[model samples]
Target: MQHTDKSLQRKVNFLLYYAVISTSIFLVFILSSFVGKDKNLTADEITVKRITVVGEDNLPRMVLSNETRQHSGRMEGKEFPKRERPAGIIFFTNKGDECGGIVAATTAKDGSVNHGMSFTMDNYHDDQVIQLLNDETYENGKAEVSRGLMFNEYPVGSNLNDRMAKTEELKKIADPKEREAKIGELWDKEGAKRRMFIGRNVNADAGVFLYDAKGKPKMKIYVDKAGNPKIEVRDSTGKYKNIIQQ
Candidate 1:
């Protein structure tokens, strides 16, 4: 009877051990199921100051935000100071450099109302090479407007950092005359050149303006707001003389 009782006690202990082990594994599986499944939520509205979209490699590829929260663009791993960017989307290149973006803004300041929108495509490591823009500034009863497509040219292989450095160096010159001369030299040789402009100039002339390699106005093929047509070419005196209209 003693041996049988001892055997029965051993069986009871084994059953308890098995029950505990099975219960622990079941609990673990239940918890893991909750953790491993993806949950989706639907929402009607979401408010945020900024949103950054990242690549699978965890680097930011795009960003949308207000100017206050906008990321200052970077080139060559160096970021410029935060500038007055409009509310819109900014894009990044594979190298994490600011490539180009779309922006729009309206504001009233100093008794003037200004509104503008722009879409730009930048050159590699440089400023905007092409831009589509519409802009207006209104004061009292008058308005100045610029609306059109523009194309700009930069020095081949010139980057923003080097350009900015040269500009800053020029600013340190104490003599106003010497500084002005140096500035003219810098601009005449290596400045950002306006290659072409197709839009309404400040004078309310809607036309295509062409420039030479030195960015001197070469031709004007446009009509004024008053319906005056001009197909003028630059003369030796550096003036636009109407050839077709005359």
Candidate 2:
């Protein structure tokens, strides 16, 4: 009977131990589940969103809808000089949420000009759409050409001025035939590097003149409509290479 009693006690102790271990494991599982729930709840509560200003209504004049993906506008006028003809109206939208108005301008009617010159004014109130009329002047109430020339946001010399300078330089060089040969050689060897550097340092539409070996003007290199340098070779047979923008 004592042996039986001892055996029964041992079984009870073993059962108790198993129950305690199972309880502990269940409690740990419960705690982990609670933590997971809290983490999921926290994640669900937080959210982020991006707001983009889009459409033709968002851009500035001289900028085309097809040319730029987001935010663009255009305006045109014939009142300005032929070379300074307004290309179209442009609208610059305020990217910041703070109180600000859209700046607008118009290009000269004649598209022959290198750059359009016109200006307009705009006002800014909190979360409001600012509209500018094409006929209006800049905030300072002056014409675009009158204010100053800006390449991107920075000021630079005018296209007319640049052209005149290049022309003067060409005149200084004497032999036209030799100049052509030199320009051809340069284009074949170092054209890409030189053009890439110039495009970076100056306005997208800036013009550059190339002279031949004899120091005479051979061809004119200027930024094309797409803002890439368009190099014209004097000899139709001359080979030219395209520079890929990295």
Candidate 3:
């Protein structure tokens, strides 16, 4: 009976041990789950090279980065290789395509200044269609400033990859005449031109300029530095048909 008592006591101890281990394990799992569910990280100041905001599918939607660490842009699910860019945030579409963002900064060195900013929004699968831009450049002892709103054209159904391929093909052309002809055919498209410009031109004229689909100037209403206001209109052939000055 003493031996029996000992055996039963050993069984009880074993059961107690099992129960303790199982309870500890369950409690640890519950605590870890609560810890994992905590998604917020609060801090007063955080410094990093880049911060990427992702969507539910774990794809980056926006990235704030320094110039060196900026995200290489994407097009139609393909990412371009890394390139030098100004420090800024890069906006991406939901499907991971690059849409647009602010890429503006100023750099001055050795008596030369390149100061400007371009706030641009791009087309669905193409380049910038509209922008607010400011450019100030002082190089080789000459200074120029251009600030304005501009609208560009992107041919419907044009693809960035197609343009890139065209550029590559142009590079392989051996004949200058043939290359120029190819350029005219490739670049001179109905919807691939600067359609409107409203700002200070390089010639220091502050005004609005409209262009046709072929990028020929169709109209201009601007004022010179001396405050002379002028309006000019062109016919279908882009010849000046009327000019009014005040």
Model 2 poorest 10 in a row by lDDT = 146-155
- Candidate 1: residue 109 Cα off by (Å): 2.6
Model 2: how far is 133 from its true place, Å?
37
lDDT of 3 by residue, 6-34 (tens): 99999999999999999999999877866
lDDT of 1 at 48: 92
Q: Can you write out model 1's per-residue Cα lDDT over 1-246, one digit (the tens) per residue? A: 999999999999999999999999999987876665474445799899999987766566899998899888878778888787788999988777888999999999999999999999998888898999999999998999999999988888868777778878998999999998997887666667888999997789999999887777899999988998889899989877888745
Model 1 has a clash total of 0
Instruction: Output the lDDT of residue 231, model 2.
Output: 63
- How badly does each model clash, as a count of residue pairs? 0, 23, 0
| Candidate 2: C-alpha lDDT | 0.39
Predicted candidate 2 versus true structure: per-residue lDDT over 193-229, tens digit per residue: 1111122112324455455533344565666547665
Query: Which sequence of candidate numbers ranks them by lDDT, best first?
Result: 1, 3, 2
Candidate 3: lDDT of 237?
68
